[model samples]
Target: MSSVLPMDLLTYWNRYAEAPITVEESRERGFGWTQYDRHGPAEELLGQPETSLELGCGTGDMTAYLARKNVRAVGVDISPVQIEHCRQRWPQDGAEFVCSDVLTYLAGTTQKWDAIFSNWGALWFTDPRAWLEPVRDHLTDNGVLVFSCAPPVEGCYGAQGMYGNGFRGRVLPVQRWAYSPEMWEGVLRNVGFLEVYAKVLEAPEPDNLGTLIVQAWAR
Candidate 1:
């Protein structure tokens, strides 16, 4: 299970979590993105491992996909409702889902993973360096950590700029912290990951602006 911070407050999370399935759906429909469609350098970086862990497996769609690839896949999230939904919706004998914060999870666990994957689940919440530390420590010597984050610059769908509600796109405002490809590599290096490869991979859609995908290998 993940060990989330108390400051986040269950009320704050649960307040939103109870509506995750609905809101998550609305956010997806309103934005037009999904786990099945979220493939890029994030997966390519891991390159198909025999074992995988999804940090914030939202509705567990990607977790199911990873389970298909490797029977021993697992996922973790902060929403209890979301975890319940994932368990009921994406039930696989070989897969497991836990409800906890990724930061807390990494703080407690020493289980080495062959591959750790987070699909847009770790962006903007906080400085990833502190959270990814556990990811680095729990990964096998030859393991790979795959995470998709907002690229530096003004290319996102403009959630805040569009909503204008001050929620700030719900992903946090870290673009300023991330400027170049090497900037992302530096974050990974801070957590002990070396051999970084990053690029701004614009998608085939005219509606998308954040196209860069950053990947790093820890060996």
Candidate 2:
């Protein structure tokens, strides 16, 4: 199946540019993979790699956070507006932002990273069957891949349609991939990843949703 059109994603994400993580908030809290801060910082899972790339880095908050920690960090997003906003928000030396489809960027770049991560980002929105292999190819030996997304809905796995609130009364179309933690681990292993781990971090409140965080080693 065809993926969500980039233009649609760009338009949908442009609506978020008005309200981004403030500089103070970014400096103080950095970034978290789980919604509602239910889990610890993402860096703990990442293990402080010397070079890292963040896929679908909205507003570049996480990228800037890593750069401050002295990691050479690059953030990639499909939205030019969000990327421009990121560039303006974090004009530091270590952080870099590129506006491109995540899969295209991964396939085109020859540079490898020590760690690659997505925080409710591209890995959720893209087809992993088409994505995981190139991601493995772009990582240094034994490099780490980490990401988080909402736990999969029962009976709904694979590319699914999601509607985003757009300008005025309009609703935009997007596609997202959802899979159970077990399914995710299997897919990663099939893509040549080793030491695969996937778990759902339950929300603090019983009524709220949980996050599925996955980590794997490139081999």
Candidate 3:
């Protein structure tokens, strides 16, 4: 399985994880943005890979979608409840769901994937410095990694902002780290990701900001 998460965070997620079928839904509702905009870019970046993996694949929606398209898809998440829900929801043969810490699972795996992606999962809870290298190492030579992250608001990075209450209109608490698109690009480059690109998509709401969709090819 996975390492223990912060007690409060674990309790919060396990309690509310069933409200929506997928993490993207929760994110869209919490961040005040439409998910369709993000989905298009994600699909385009993903293409059609023979083997794919999703980090922090909450509920396995993305993983199941990939599997339906004939990819050997695997999803890993730290939350056991979420993984259990995912397996129950998508009991297809093409996809596999594992409840494990992303770094721990990546470190132990000898299989390299053609594509790896996440939509607002692990990147939110942990520092990228800890997992980016491991992610790069887990990919095949020509593999691609794609992920989406929300931009930081005025005080989102400060101590007071650590706790996201009423995010996406939910009372549950969430742990998320917001970073600049430039910083994301730099980190991917530093970790040896090639042809790195960050595409910014504005939130449909006139008053809201947008998301950064990043794609990096492994060397």
Candidate 4:
């Protein structure tokens, strides 16, 4: 099992933001082309939401898209540099980016969101009950939260799973999490979200990793 340090990952993403341009690895790891084929977060916008919050927005590409939709969109990420890139791409006054762990913001802040969504994001929570409840609490009464999560491709639980087989004692962390289909179904119900739409989509690619997508309506 491999353990993940969420804050550390955020700081690493910040370094990418300082680069002259988006790096090749960042482009791949951020997962736009593959995730976009299935989720198309931009296309799903229902038109000018009164307010929107996106968690784990990498490079803030989709957040910028949301801003242009004439919606009040705010993106929260753990990376300061990522926030900087976001600031540069879309200068709309209403589109804001924050530097904080999504869980920390959700737990500490009293703000309620009108609509919440994350793409290729929201899977860092080792304890779903702990992390997800915060997400649910941050949602307004009639609000919606949509995100994509995946279970590990193989046996991975804590440190061993996350780091994979260490080569000569040097550990490399690969993709870290995945959820069983049934596990996801139950989590939403426990969080008081009614099943609106759930689908298993082919991840774009030669690799073609799969995605378990659940978009639920809040009760």
Candidate 5:
């Protein structure tokens, strides 16, 4: 599979490569501040394993957490800036940071991980089918694919919307795929995931539909 760079999304995230890691500072900057609460830590989701991959890891915060738990954690990101931040911030022996498009990296890698996860990462920006097979191929038997994404919201269709402030005061449009839980389950099943679980949890704030939490196991 050819790796198509999602340049717009990468550029938008680059702006936050140097952003603060604190919840208060992140919330102020409009990043997903509640991600920690939504998905918990890596070990909590997948248990302490021998090896794991944090897909689309922004600043490698969760990647660091996984490494701390004695898992050899590899954090992959499309943005070089974010990967650089990860390397500098964590500097752990077991943690590795790679600057590569997630899809391309997955397709080209021979590594089989015990667990793989993404916390509202670029998985939202690509077709579910595109990555499912690669994930299955790269995950060890019984390994799980866990991720959380913005559940469908009012007027969130297709792959484009107002996302961020661009260079020189311009507004950047977002690109993401926000499908329903049932739709996601079907795709996961069709792509060889043995058991698929999906749920929409209430958002912390009212007036929002909530988040879609998904876990599909490789049997």
Candidate 6:
């Protein structure tokens, strides 16, 4: 079970509806797992899947990148505002955007993808014990799952409360799952992933937090 309230989570993400993803920004960033501009291991791990689905695909830049790369890409987000923004931004780009909860969407879809990924997205916010199995079932044979999130805080290894925006005082409660690389690997393997690998990529600067990236292959 997820600690996050559905409506609160929706509202929290809707606040980012105005954040624009410019052409230059997309070109420069170019689909990365880390929050920083540098490309991470996901590019190599994904390896040009014929079809892909992005969970919690926020402004849809990564999804659009996949579409531009000639992959059949679909982006699912809970916020209608975000989905609309994505559609308006890339009307003819061949990337499909759906506004729905990640678990609900996964349960309803009968289609399987070659690659399913989330970038600081649904995988972090949802309960892996319940969420991961469905994700594995939705993949084609030998399919891959990749996701990135902040590493677990010392003494905090499960769902934790986070604020959407602190500066503006519009802080809303949202829950995120944090786990160490080892824990993530164990969790994925327990869910029947044949090959599980998890690592924490060091941040560019010494003082910043690193990104925990996990990749698993379906049996």
Clashing pairs in 1: 3-104, 3-105, 200-212
Write the residue-wise lDDT of candidate 4 on 1-219 in tens digits. 346565555544665457533434433343232344333333353333577888877677666666766767888877777777777765664578887777877877898877787766544433566667777777777777766655345654422234333466434354434555566677678777775555555655536666656666667
- Residue clash pairs of candidate 3: 29-168, 30-168
Question: lDDT per model, in order?
Answer: 0.61, 0.85, 0.72, 0.62, 0.74, 0.85
Query: Against the hidden reference, what TM-scores do the models get?
Result: 0.71, 0.91, 0.80, 0.73, 0.81, 0.91
Kindly give the stretch of ten consecutive residues in candidate 5 with the minimal lDDT sum: 25-34
Model 2 TM-score is 0.91
What does candidate 1's lDDT look like per residue over 94-143, in tens digits?
57888987887777776777878776674434455466667777777788
Model 3 C-alpha lDDT per residue in residues 1-219, reported as the tens digit of each score? 233346656665666566654544633433211254443344557766899988988877778777877889999988788888888777754789998888989988899999988887776676676878888888888888988867666445511233334445334445566666676777788878867887677776756667767889967
Question: What lDDT is obtained when candidate 6 is compared to the true structure?
Answer: 0.85
Runs of candidate 1 with Cα error greater than 4 angstroms are: 1-42, 154-179
lDDT of 6 by residue, 149-179 (tens): 8888878888887676565655566778888
Q: Residues 44-148, candidate 5: write the lDDT tens digits.
A: 557556888978888777677667678888989988899887787777446899999889999887999988988777687667658878888998887888888
Query: Which residue ranges in model 6 land beyond 4 Å of their true spot?
Result: 1-5, 163-172
Better structure of 2 and 3 per TM-score: 2
- Candidate 4 lDDT at 20 equals 37
Worst 10 residues of 4 by lDDT: 157-166
Residue-wise C-alpha lDDT for candidate 2, range 13-116, written one tens digit per residue: 78766688677776777678987743555687888699999999998988888898899999999888889989998996479999998998988889999999
Model 3 CA RMSD to the hidden true structure, in angstroms: 5.6
